[model samples]
Target: MDLQLTNKTAFITGSTSGIGFAIAKALLTEGAVVIINGRSQKNIDSAVKQLQAFVPNGKVSGIAVDFKDPSAMDAVKQKIDQLDILINNVGIYASKSFDKTTTNEWHEMFEVNLMSSVKLSKYFLPKMKANNWGRIIFISSECAQLVPEDLIAYSATKAAIQALSRGLAQTTKGSNVSVNTLAPGSTLTESAQEYIKNQAIIEHRSEEDVADDFFKKVRTSSLLQRFTQPKEIADMAVFLASPLSSATNGAVIKVDGGSIPGIV
Candidate 1:
C-alpha cells in the first residue's frame, strides 16, 4: 500500500542502527522526509548514507544528540519547527541485578528511556494539535509486562512509556493527531546479533544454538521461540505512523510475537 506518507516529515531518535534505524528506513521507503538521531556525528553520517543507498531517492538527514544531557534536544528544536511524525525510540539499558545496579544507572535509564520521550512530546505535541494532524509513536518493549529480574529499572521506564503515550493521546481528542505505544518482544538488532555471536564463541556452541537457548531458557514465554527481526517491529511502526492508523490512538499495540501471552 502507498501509506500516503509522501513528503511527511518524521524524526526518529537513536536511529543509527537497530530498530530505530529500521523504522527510519521504512519511513524513507514510504517517501517521508526522515531526520535520524544518534549520539555522534560520525555514526549519524554513516547511517544517513546507508539509508540513502537503501532508498535511493529518500530525503534523509541526521542530528547528533546525547539524551543523557537533557539540554541536548535544544539543538534539534533549532533545526525543525514541526513534524508529522515523532517516534520516541531512543533508549538505554543495563542488565544488572537490582542491588548491583547503581543509583546513577537508574537515573540514566529513566533519562534516556522515558524523559527523552516526555521532553520531545512536550515540545511537538502542541504543534501537531495545532496543525490537526500528526502521529506520535513510542517504542516500548514487552519487558514492561514481563519485567525480568535484571531489568527492573528498564522495565519501569518502559511501563511509564505506555502511560505517557496514552495520556498524550487524550490531549489529541477529536483531532487527526494520534499517539500510541508499540511494545516489541526480543528483537534481533545489530547489538543482539553481536551478543549472540560472542555467546556462541564463549560457550563453544553454534550461533543458532545460543540464540535458540535464549528463547528456551531466558525468554521461555516466547511462543515464536526466536528473536524477532528489527524490520518486523518497524513495519508496524510505519503503519502506525501513517494515516491508515487513524483509529489506533491511546492503544498499547504489541508486536511482541506472542512473547507477551494473553489475548488483548
Candidate 2:
C-alpha cells in the first residue's frame, strides 16, 4: 500500500476543511508535500496547524485564495511553478429552484465550481505534460447524474467537470500525466453536518433520525443508506493522485453510496 508518493508535491484547493482537508491529510500521511488552500490567512494558518499536528512531521503549508473571486487565483499562480498532483476540489453550491435561483447565483456556481478547475488545469496541466508526469483530479459530485431538483445549477457545473476532465485527459495521450474525475455521493462534510443538525432541531428529532430520513426520503436511491465520510472519498482521491493510478486517465469514477444508478 505504499502509494509511492514520497517527495511528490500536491496542491488541493479549498483544503482548509471537508473532503479537501481529508485529501491533504492523506497525501501528507503518504509523505507528499501538500499545499492547502483556503480563503483567509487565519483559516489557512489554523488548518496548517491542525494538519501538522494530525500528520506526524508532515510538510504542509497553505495559501489564502478565495476561489469565489476569480482574480484571487492569480496570487496562486505566482506561488508554485510545478506540481506533481493538482486537485481541483474548490466549489460552491446553492440549493434553489430554477425560478428562485438568481442569475448571479447561477454565474457564481459556474465560476467557482467549474471555472476554478478550468483555471487551475490551464496553468498546471501543461507544466505537468512538459515534466512528463503528473495527476490532475477534479472532485465532481453524484448530483451530476442524479440531477436533484433544487441543485440544478450545482449539478450542471459538476456535469461540465466530467466533460472537462475527459477532454483534458484526451490531451495527455501517451504521457504519464493523467486527468480524471471522482464523483462523490452524499458526504459528511461540515455543510452536511450543519444540515443534519438544523433538520433535527426543526423536526424535533435526533441527528441520527434526521440522517436516516435523508437517506430514506431525499436520497432514497442511496444503497449505503448513510453519508460517506470525507476520508472515504479522500482515500479514492489519494489513490488516483498517486503514480500507481497511471492507467485510470479520463475516467469518471464514482464513490457514491450507489446513488448514481447506471451499469456503466
Candidate 3:
C-alpha cells in the first residue's frame, strides 16, 4: 500500500475546502508535498494551517489564485515551478433552467473549469515530459455523462475535461507521465450536507427523506443509494496520483457509486 509517492510534489487547485481539500489531505498522507490553492488568501492560509496540523512533519504549502482572472492565472503560473503531480480540481457550477443560463455564465464556467486546466497543462506538461515522470489528474463529474438539465453548462465543462485529459495523455505516448480524469458522483461534502438540510426544511421532510428522494427519484441510476463521502473519492485520487498508477493513462475513472450506468 505504499503509494510510492514519498517526496512527490503535488498542486491541487481549489484545495481550500470540499473534495479538493480532501484530496490534498490524502496525498499528504501518502507523503507527497502538497500545494493547496484557493481564490482567497484567507482561505488558502486557513487551509494551509489545517493541513499542517494534520501532516505535522509533512511539507504543505498554499497559493491563492483566482483562475477566473486571466492576469491572476499568469501569476499562478509564475509561482509554480516544477511539479510531480498537477491536479486540475478547481471548478464552478450553477443550477438553473437552461433558458435562465446566460452566455456569460457559460463562459465563466468554461473559463474556470476547462480553460484553467488547459493553461496549467500547457505550462507544466512539457516540464514533466522532460523529466519523464508526472501525474496529471482532472476532477470531472458524473454529470458529464448524465447531462443534467439544470446543469448544462457545468456538464459541458466536465465533458470538455474528459476530452482534454485523453488528448494530453496521447502526447505522453512512451513517457512515464500519465494524464487521467476522475468523475465522481454526488459526494457528501460539507456544502452538500448543508444543501440537503436546507432542502429538507423547504420540503418539510426529514433530512434522511430528502436524501432517499434524491436516489429514488433524481438519481434513479445510483446503486449506492446515498452520497459518496469525500474521503472515498480522495482515496481514488491519491492512488491515481501515485507512481503505482503509471499504467492508467488517458482514462476516465468513475468513482460515481454506479450512478453513471453502462460498462466502460
Cα misplacement distance, residue 154 of candidate 3 (Å): 0.7
Using TM-score as the measure, name the better of candidate 1 and candidate 3. 1
Alpha-carbon deviation at 38 in model 3, angstroms = 0.8
What ranges in model 2 sit over 4 Å off?
Answer: none
- What tens digits encode model 3's per-residue C-alpha lDDT throughout 134-204? 99999999999999999999999999999999999999999999999999999998888999999999999
For each of the candidates, give the backbone clash count.
0, 0, 0
Q: Put down candidate 1 lDDT per residue, 1-264, tens digits, no spaces.
A: 889999999999999999999999999999999999999999999999999899999999999999999797799899889999999999899999999999999999999999999999989999999999999999999999999999999999999999999999998989999999999999999999999999999999999999989988899998888889999999999999999998899999998889898888
Count of clashes in candidate 3: 0
Cα lDDT computed for each candidate against the true fold? 0.95, 0.94, 0.94
Question: For each candidate, what TM-score against the reference?
Answer: 0.99, 0.99, 0.98
Candidate 2 colliding pairs: none
Give residue 152's error in model 1 in angstroms: 0.3
Tell me how candidate 2 scores on lDDT. 0.94
The list of candidate 3 runs beyond 4 A from truth reads: none
Between prediction 2 and prediction 3, the one with superior TM-score is: 2
Q: Ten-residue segment with the worst summed lDDT in candidate 3?
A: 70-79
Compared with the true structure, model 3 gives a TM-score of: 0.98
Alpha-carbon deviation at 205 in model 2, angstroms: 0.4
